[model samples]
Target: MSQVFDYIVVGGGSGGCVIAGRLSEDPNLTVCALEAGGRGDGTLVNTPTGAVAMMPTRINNWAFDTAPQAGLGGRTGYQPRGKTLGGSSAINAMVYIRGHRSDYDGWAALGNEGWAWDDVLPYFRLSEHNERFDDAWHGRDGPLWVSDLRTGNPFHARYREAALQAGLPLTDDFNGAQQEGIGIYQVTQKHGERWSAARAYLLPHLGRRDNLTVETHAQVLRIVFDGTRAVGVEVKQHGEVRTLRVRREVVLAAGALQTPQLLMLSGIGPARELERLGIHARLDLPGVGRNLQDHPDFIFGYRARSTDTMGVSLRGGLRMLLELARFRRERRGMLTSNFAEGGGFLKTRPELDAPDIQLHFVVALVDDHARRFHLGHGLSCHVCLLRPRSRGSVTLRSANPLDAPRIDPAFFADARDLEDMVAGFKLTRRLMQAPALARWITRDMFTAHVNTDDQIRDVLRQRTDTVYHPVGTCRMGHDALAVVDPQLRVRGVQGLRIVDASVMPTLIGGNTNAPTIMIAEKAVDLIRGVSRVAAQPHNDAQAEPHVEPHANYAPQARTVEARHAIA
Candidate 1:
């Protein structure tokens, strides 16, 4: 006899943790959360700087490599998703951004009702407990904690000065009245430690709640369907396959890459792909693993003259040791740095409706998602296209459940995205040349003497890759290709819901973590049949943004290059 639960949340990731935690709040509803990785309670997860060690290695990470992309000149991109309980939140840079307000409104425009900026703002507020702000825009009491960086580094001011010198506006808050400016990013941290989604929602409720059962190393092979209804899951835990029955729903929070893979593995994806793999098609949902979207990023690395920037050196090593001591004592120092210490939102051209590009100013030189390390102290600034017309997919490598899914983020498939990236690069390069930053830099690590649009395009194709935001595989919409409805229920199946980034119809305008948590927070209400109707925007929330005009960017932003296809 298999154990039963009212809800069986697959993948104890960012979304799964919230789903399980929220459902289990009712003593009557028994919820079980299954994670394929360990319990994510290690020092590596709690410490903010430990991500430097975790992201570059396979410790609690999936570390999957994509199929060779012709976009990056035939180079395979590295995707380091968190396999542990917190999911990517445990391994990510901990930058908490809710994208742009227009992002959610755009989703509503695409037939996803109740997802407009006004509709989702309540959920965003409901999930946050801000350390600084307590206004209409931010929540004062919530499960998740959002706080300013504890590292009082002098570079924060310098980064601000650099942006100002480059003629960008300033905003004290991104999740406030304005989001279109440069500012220090507020992180999902509390008291200098990383406050991942699981940490905020699940960890505290562990032994306190008898209705909640958190299972680690439990990998679900497939959803056990009773005809078209998902009634249970067949999971492999500790080398023993077990059937965990679900009384009400089988929710998948297995992230963008895996949730769709699980659907396909359960014979609910494209009929042609299932037939080729010899799996009987239970539900012919063609959009199960389609519509993959990500932020294709280009980095500008500069060797810094100052030793204060985080890097490997005798002087920096001595400083890090001191910072470690300070962290242990007061939880405030360079050890609390999230690497991407500074962030900005900008439009390549003044005519765009919203910011076309985003920036992540890393305190250290991060190469290949921090896989390859460089010597000496340096800083890196990442510029990525916020909304790429390019699309990709996540499909089955084989019929085997244990096999990794194929991820193909066909970057630059649309010629327009590359051109926008070129304009963004030039704008960022101008900031790098500003006196505030230029005085600290020795030389450029990449893109030196590369001026022309064609040269920029070639280098972009050679060097551009993801900034770790992947979404929209199991797209949520009313359209036929949409795997899930706006309510997040699987289209052709019953008792199955996807509550992760995969359900996003389109990638948001900024970091995805905060928005993903809001998705799960809203999903809980949907699951409980108590979902609120999206309210109108707050009185103060609807102000027009103050955008500085760039008369020169609009004309030269056009692409003169031909489209390139990946083989």
Candidate 2:
């Protein structure tokens, strides 16, 4: 029997949860959301400490690895995405950052209409129920809970003080009027418990509404297309295959890595690639799996002089035992910590339009997304290039949907990106060495010996990986290769839309979780025909050149040659 719904949301992730939950608000509509993973409300999914364990393993993570990158000496980089109802949000750092306002404006400038900061600001406010902030910039009543650090950990204050002592300015809010500065990061939590999109949006409506259906362990194979229109999806659940029909639209809320792979499997990708794989092309959308962008990140590790950091030791193990009791009683303790307690956006060059890099101060010594372990207590800091000229792709490993996509981030593909990272390394190293944090550091572990630009470049290439903010694969724009338009409608495919990070035309300055939820919130309005701004086909010549959405992309023209100016 074919299940039927007015709307079928594929991939019950951050975006799918919002899409299904909001559409269910209209009693007249029937919605079905299918997740590839288990229910994301388990103890491991809700506990912040569990994220540390999950990321290093496949507990609730896809734990995908990239194809060998020439930039990293032909080494494969780890890519850990959440494999649960909340998607990556369930196993993320829980940092509630919406990115810089200029990032959205940059999208609008590139011919994506109605996506400017001013237009998308309302959606950001609409999705957040902030616990501490209440102003023109924040919302007080919403599903997602955004709050200040509720734990008693004292490391965030020390990190911020170090950033300030290192000559960086302080900004209380990274999402406010000013986007430049260092401060304690706000998290997606409620009473110290992890508040993922599933908890905030979908879980509430699971049993409350018969109109909405959320199926777990249901892997979407491909879209069932009648000609060029997507009418349903063929899903495999419990070792059974079934076709679920959609009355109106089929929205792909899968993240950047999976969405394009699904589209390609459905015969809606580059015609040549599809033909070579023995699959008939339905739409020949050349940009389907192209334009992959992720933050190329490098972490600086150090041996801690104090016991404030999270590490393996007799004292730390004892503290953890006591924290388990404290957390069970009040949900507030060291167990509530979201390892990355402090972070900020900073500019490497004074001439750049916005911050070219971002900082994440961790309470533990993180190596390869915590895949690698170390002894004793230590701390680490991450410095990632915010905007890179490099662009990679997501292509099908095989015609089989069960197979993982071949992810090629092509980190530092553009030479300038490496240069900028070299510059960023110097700037970040100085901040870590500031006197405010010097007292806490016993010895530098990774980059202490790195001094020369060439040495920095060599070390970065050796250790650089992703900060897990991959976007722009199924890009939204008004170009020949665009997969979706500004309204998020798939090009050349009727009754199909992509409402996820895959549609991001460019990379945002900070964490992608908050912005992803906002994208889904705005997508709901667009789908209901209640969009505030009407979409238009833009071909403005005054705008920047249309950045290619493919494997071999031209470097951004704005990339400034790194001079030893600031250092």
Candidate 3:
């Protein structure tokens, strides 16, 4: 007999891992997780900095690229997604951040109730075991471990100094009372090892319950539907097709790009779009792939003289081997740092309610992520736009699930977006040239001496790229354009739900991994009816002073940093 499960979670990513672990807690409900990638068993993934090389490699990552974005000077952006058991979390920089309260309020405003900042804060707290903060916003007992850095290199301090010297305020915690200013970023690490979703959720529950089954290298082609309700999934394993039945529901945690693509492949998207692809329409959800959003990042590199540089290539071949040996032995040294630590949120203009841009300081002079340079002494500061007005879409290229979809982020399509990015670039340059950074700067490496607005704009256009935080493809809302409801259930389909970054109505102000996990926690309550369906749309007027935008950007005018992957 074919295997049957109570919950079949497609794509064992951040959300899938959490959902599978949480739902299986009952021990009676059978849960099965399907992953397209191989197992997560490599020294490279366990060691903090060792993941750098594994990130871009085909062995562990999907390494998908976007169709040329019209807004980004027609350049096809590179999108790297994790394919391993832990998904992107396995290959991420492991930064842990919950976005500002306003981010959730925006969702509520759009008709998803109970998703407002105050309502969802508990879920964030519930999923975290923070090493610091035991007050209202944080938790002390949770499966996931969140902690501050135990050690810091010289470069982390210098970067913090630069932000202060640039006239930006210095805040101790972005997740605290305020998000503005610069400080060291808290990471998702335990004893210098990456605490990925697989490690935190799956590993603990594996083999403990016969009700849970994990199918790796099993690529799901489409959901098996009995009329309008999803019955199970059709998958391919070892080059052979197999079908499994779900006694209860088929949860889609396939993420932003894949969730929509899966829906379309299952004939659940716009009627016309699916018909055009010669697929029978299962459900006509017009918003299956609309309202796509992501954060775009602009990086500034500088050549520095102090011991602030953290490039591994700076040392000799023997020295590099020695460092690796040390990391293997104790999980300490430069290898443990995520490099992207030391970031803060800041407003481009003083009148804004909350900071619109964020900065991440890296000790390495990452030219193509340290690919070409044999050795160099420099630093990189990446600035990301917190909120963007421009939107994009994902559409099916073919009815086949193996075929990738066409992704158009529509990045800088609006002139106002260009203005915001330019402003961010100028502000970041000011931080780099701050008196605190003056003590360490040997010279400018990437964009030499940016004094003029035009110069800053030019540099921004040339250097801007993705920080890998893609979201909002299958947005949650009450409108006809919304793909899913507040509970993350697909609007027109039964027994099918999307549970990844794809369901976000708007991108959060910070990294997405932690929030995605929180979404899973929130979803559990909604599915079990422990939480109420949204009674009213999110109220911007009711939002605290921090989250409401002083001015709303035209959907086409605002630009965001195209940071889609994990930090």
Candidate 4:
């Protein structure tokens, strides 16, 4: 006999962990979580600096590659996702940031009720337990632990000084009243260890809850549907194929890239695409794998004069050994560093409603996603466009579920995006040239000689890639292209819901992890039929000024022409 669960959460990533953990809290309900990766409790996932080693190796990452992008000069970009219990959160740089207020308000403007900044702020507060802040804007009792950087490098202070020198304000809290400023970031850490979603919501309750079942290394092949309703999932576990029955619902939280792939593989995509792939159609949802979006990022690297920055050398190797010992004993020192230690938000134009660009100051020379290494110590800065107009899709490479899906982000397909990248490059260059940082820079390793707009564009076309924040594939809304409704239920299917970053109608203005957790936090309410009301008081002062949905600083016709030409 097959054991039945009231709820089955697939892919124990950021949203999966939260959904499973919250649903299992009811002693009467049986919840099961299926993860396609190993337990995320290893030392590498716990140590903040461990990401440096994990980025280049396939240790716990599904380091997939994108289809060659025309906008990127036919270069294939790298896409590394966490193949562990916590998913990408386990392998991500631990910076914790909630996007601008208008990001959620924009969702409301797009016909997603109950998702405005006022409505979602409570959920964000509910999921966070910030160590340094306890106010109406923040919650003191939550599952996720957010803290200040324990090992504050000297270079971090210098980065802030440079930002001020470049005419940027210093903000103590990026997640507070305002987001447009520069400062050291607060990370998802607990007493200096990485606090992944598993550590926050799932790990402590694993064995204690008898109704909760967690299956690791279980790969789900397809959704078992009875007509239009999702009833169960076909999974392969430990060399055996089986069906896990869901009595009430099945939540797909396999992330932005894989969630749509899972849906398409289950014969629930565009009818023509499914037929072409030789799969019988279960549903004819044309929006299943469309609307792919990601932040297009470019890095500025320079040789550093200080040994404080990370590098490959005998002296640094010896320091790492001592740091490891210190980490084991006190949980403090260089091992606690999340490489992109300091960053903040900025608006390129003063008239913009919210920040259009985000900066990440790194203590290492990261080339090609850390796949390429430099011999000497250095520092780098990542400038990523907060919102991009380009769109792409995820399609099935084959009918087999084991095959990786084809990803096309279509970066800079819209000319406005390229223009913004160029402006952002110039702005970031000014910050890098500030005396605080320029004093340590020995020589420019990437873009020193480039001066003209065409030269900058050429450099961006050759080197730009993702910052790992992809969203909007299975976007939620009431539009013709919306795959999921405002409640997160698959529009044409029953007993199925998507609660990951994929459901975002538009990408948020900052990191997506915290918002993804908030999605699950609100999802449990909808699943349980509970009336969820905002707990925090709303203030118009914190509200963002209204702006058009797809407003861009560039002339509209030029951008449209560029988009059409690229298409």
Model 2: per-residue lDDT, tens digit, 1-567? 339999999987899999999999999999999999999999988888889889979987899999999998899998999899999999999998888878998999999988888788888888889886776567778999987776667776677667656777666677766677777788999988999999998998888997989999999999998887888999999999999999899999989999999999999999999989988888889998899999999999998966678999999999889888989999988888899888878888778778888999888898878878899989899999999999999998899999999999999999999999988898888889888888889889998788888899899999999999999999999888899999999999799999999999999998999999999999999899886433332332333322213221112312322232456
CA shift of 274, model 3, Å: 2.0
Residues 384-482, candidate 1: write the lDDT tens digits. Answer: 999999999999999999999999999988888888888888888887788999999997988887988899999899889989999999999987899
Residue 111 deviation, candidate 1, in Å?
1.6
Model 3 per-residue lDDT tens digits across residues 322-369: 656777787766677777867878888877877788888876676654
Residue 335 C-alpha lDDT in model 4: 90
TM-score, per-candidate, Cα-based: 0.94, 0.94, 0.91, 0.94
**lDDT minimum window of 10 residues, candidate 2:** 545-554
Give the runs in model 3 whose Cα sits over 4 Å from its true position.
Answer: 306-308, 312-322, 369-374, 449-451, 531-567
- lDDT for each candidate structure: 0.88, 0.87, 0.77, 0.88
Q: How accurate is candidate 2 locally (lDDT)?
A: 0.87
Candidate 1 regions off by >4 Å?
532-536, 540-567
